[model samples]
Target: MHIQMNDIYKAFGANQVLTGVHFDLKEGEVHALMGENGAGKSTMMNILTGLHKRDSGKIVIDGEERYFDNPKEAEKHGIAFIHQELNVWPDMTVLDNLFIGKELRSPFGLLKTKEMKALAKKQFDKLAVTIPLEKEAGLCSVGEQQMIEIAKALMTNAKVIIMDEPTAALTEREIEKLFNVINALRKEGVSIVYISHRMEEIFAICDRITVMRDGKTVDTQMVSETSFDEVVRKMVGRELTDRYPERNPNIGDTILEVKNATRQGVFEDVNFSVKSGEIVGVAGLMGAGRTEIMRALFGLDQLDSGEILINGQKASIKNPFEAVKRGIGFITEDRKNEGLVLDFSIRENMALPNLTSFSKNGFIAYKTETDFVDMLIKRLRIKTESGETSAKNLSGGNQQKVVIAKWVGIGPRVLILDEPTRGVDVGAKREIYQLMNELTDRGVAIIMVSSELPEVLGMSDRILVVHEGKISGELLKNEATQEKIMTYATGGQ
Candidate 1:
C-alpha cells in the first residue's frame, strides 16, 4: 500500500505531541522512522494506525484520502501494527493469541481448530519461528514473543506493516530470520514502516529514512544518501560527540559478590563479584539466563542455593525490599512492566523507592520530594512537561530515564542495570553512559547486562559471558572483543 500523512497535528490537553508532521510509505519499501524518544515518532505512527485521532491531517492511502475509526479498521484495510510492547495474552495459548478476535468458526458456530492451527503453522514456518502453538504465550521468551508478534502481523496479509522496535529483544540469529522474512515480504509488495533506535538495523534494512525532531519532520532522505551522523544530528537536533562516553576506572574492593548461585532449571553455579567504582558487563544471548540471574540477585526470584555478599559480609535478601535495604538497586530490562508503574506520575515513580528519605514524622515532605524529582528530571535530561505528568505519557527513552532516576534516588552501593539503553536513542544513550560513569566515580559498583555488543565492550571494565546458565568465560577491558565475547557466549572454550 502507498500511504501518505501530511500536516498531522495532535495534542493531549496542554502538551502538543505531533505538529505538522509529514510521513509517507511507498509500496514494497521499508521506510525507517528515526527520532529521539518523545520526538513524535510513535505519535505519528499511532495516528497512522488509528490508535490516536489527529486533530488535523490528511491521510491519503493509494491516492485517496482516508481515515480509520480504530486499529481494527486499519487492520481490515491491510495495515497491521506490531507495537514495541508485545500484546500477547499471557494465559492464552499461542494458537488462541494468534486467532484472538478473528477466529475461524464453522457454520454451526463451532471453533475451526484444525484450520486455525494450519494457518498459524504456515505463518510460523514463513518467519522461521519454532514456538509451539499449544504452549501458553506467557511461557515464551521475550525474543520468541517478539517473533510471535511479527508472525501475527504477517498472518493478516498486511499490505503495510508498522513495526515498532521489532528486533529489540531478538538475538543475532533471530534478527537474521526476521530480516529474511522482511526481504521476502518486500519482494511480495508489502511496505513496512520500520521504527527503531538501532541505527545499524535501519541502515541494514531500510530503503529510505524520515527523521523527526520535537513533533515535526526535519528531513526525509534515501538510506544511501544519508549518513548515520547526519540522521542522528537531525533526530536529536544536535551533533552528538560520541556514542559512548570515556570511562576512567578507579578500582576498589569488592562491593557485591554472588557465590555459587543456583536457580534449578534456569541458571546454575553463577560466581561473580563487582567491585566499587567498576562496571561489570554481563553478555549473553536472549535466553542465556542473563535476566534470570539479575532477577535472583534482586530477590524477585529465589535461588535454590546461593550466597550474596555485600562488603565482604553475607547478606540475607528475601525480597526486593530487602535487596533495597541492602543497598542494591535494579533497573530491569522490561521497563514497561517491571521498571515503572505506567499510571503513576514521573515524580511518583521516582520517589517510590526512596519514600523513607522524602518522609518525616510519618508525613510526606512535599517540598523535599518535589525538589528531588525536579533535580533528577534536569539531571537526566528527561523530556516532559512536568514531573506531575503521567509516566505512561512519556516516550520510552524518558520512561527509562525515570527508571534509572528511581534507582539512583535509593543511593545504591551496587547497581544492577539490565538492558539499560534498550530502545533509547543515540543521544539519550550517551547521557545514560555518562550517568553510569558518574555513579562509578562515586564508588558505586555496577553490573550491566546488555544484548548490544558494542555497549558491552564500550562501557564495561570487565566482561563476563554467560552460556547455559553459567559464567562461561571472563575478559578484561583491554582483551575483550566482539568475536571473543560471542565465542564465550555461545559456549566456546
Candidate 2:
C-alpha cells in the first residue's frame, strides 16, 4: 500500500491540532514519524486511519483519493493500528481477543472455534510469539500483549500497520524480537508507520523519516542521509543541548531504606536505600520485579515480611494515603490509569494530593489551588491552554509533566519514580532529568526504576540491578556501564 497525505488540517474547537501536514508511506518500507508531544504526529495518523476527520486534506492511496469512514472500514482495506496502550480484554482468552468482532462462524450460526485457533496460531508463529492461545489476555506480560496485538493485525492481512510507541513497555530482549518481526513484515511488502520518541530505535529500523513541528511538516529525509541532531532540531524547532542534564552530587544521610523487603511470589529480599539528595536507579528487565518492589514501597502492594525505615526510624505505610502523609511520593509507571485522573482538569488532578495544604477550616481555597497549578505549569513548561483543560487532552510528555508536578506539589522528602520518561520525547526527557537534579538539590531522595540503560547510567548516582526478584548487584555511577548493568540484570555477578 502506498499513501500520501497532503495539506491535512484538523482542529478541535479553538485548538488547532494539524495544519498543512504532509506525510507519505511507500509500500514495503518502514517510515518514521518524529516529533515532540502535541506536534500533531498522532493526530495526523489518527486522520489517516479515519479515527479523526481532516478538515481539508487529500489522502491518496495507490493514486486514488480515499477517505475511510471509520477505523474498521480502514482496517477492512488493509490498515491496522496497534496503539501504545495495547487493547487486550483481560478476562477473555487470547484466541477470543484475536478474533474479536470478526469471529468466524459456521452456516448454522455456531462459532468456528477450531478454524479461529488454527488461524491465530499461524499468525503467532509468523511473529515468533509463544503466548498460549488458551491463556487469559490480561495474564500476559506487556511484551506478550504487544505481540498479540501485532499478530492480531497480521491476522487481518493488513498491508499497512501503524505502530504507536510499540516498545515503550518492552524489555531489551522483547524489543529485539519485535524488531525481527518488523523486518520480516517489511520483506513481505507491508508498509509501516512507526511512531516513537526513541531516536536510537528510529535510526536503527526506519528507512525514511518525516519531521513535524507545531502541526506542520518540517522535513522528510532518508534515515541514512539524516543525522540525529538534525532530526531533533527539526522536531523541536531548536538545538537541544544534551539528552540528559548534568548531576552534581551533594549526598546526604539515608532518607529511606528497605531491609529484606519480601513480597513472596512477586519479589524477595529487595534490600536498598536512597539518601537525601541522591538518585538511586533500579535497573532490570520488564517483569524482573522492578515495578513490584516500587509498588510495595508506595503501599500499593503489601510487603509480606520487611522493614521500611524513614530517616533511621521505622515507618509504617499501609496505603497510599499513609505513604503521602509520611512525605513519600510515588509516580507510578502506568500514568494513564494510576497517576492521573484522565477526565479531570489539570487543576483538579494536581489538587488531588495537596488538597489538605490548599484547604482551610474544612473549606477549599480555589485561588490557592489555581495559583499552585499555574506555577507548576510554567515551571515544568507544560503545554496546555489552561489549568481547566482536561488531562486527557494533553500529549504524552505534558501528561508526564503533570504527573511529576502533582507529586512535587506535596513537597516529598523521598520520591519514587517508575519509568518516568517511558514514552516522552527527547526534549521533555531532558527537562525531567533537570527536574530530578533540582529535586535532589533540594534534599529530596529519589528511587528511579527504569528499563532504559542510558537513562539509568546518566541520571543515577548509584545503580541497583534486579534479577529474579533479588538485588543481583550494585554499581556506582562511575563504574556502571550498559554491559555491567545487563549482566547483573540477567543474573550475573
Predicted structure with the largest TM-score when compared to the true one: 1
Candidate 2 residues lying further than 4 Å off, grouped into runs, are none
Predicted model with the maximum lDDT: 1
**Which 10 residues in a row give candidate 1 its minimum summed lDDT?**
122-131
**What TM-score goes with each of the models?**
0.99, 0.97
Q: List the residue pairs that clash in candidate 2.
A: none
Candidate 1 lDDT over residue span 1-493, tens digit each: 8999999999989899889999989999999998998899888888888889999989999999999888999999999999987799989999999989999999999999999999999999887788999999989988888888888889899999999999889888789999999999999999999999999999999999999999999998899998989998898888988888899989899999999999999999999999999999999988999999999999999989989999989988889999999999999988888899999999999999999998889999999999999999999999998999999988888999999999999999999999998889888999999999999999999999999999999999999999999999999999999999999989888
Tens-digit per-residue lDDT, 1-493, candidate 2:
9999999999988999898999989999999998988899888888988999999989999999999989999999999999876689989999999999999999999999999999998887766677899999988876678788878887888999999998888888888888998999999999999999999999999999999989999999899999989998998888988888889989999999899999989899778899999999999987788888888888999989999999999988989999999999999877887889999999999999999999999999999999999999999888899999999999877888999999999999999999999888888888889999999999999999998999999999999999989999999999999999999988877
Clashes (backbone N, CA, C under 3 Å), per candidate, total 0, 0
lDDT of each: 0.93, 0.91
- Which residue segments of model 1 deviate by more than 4 Å? none
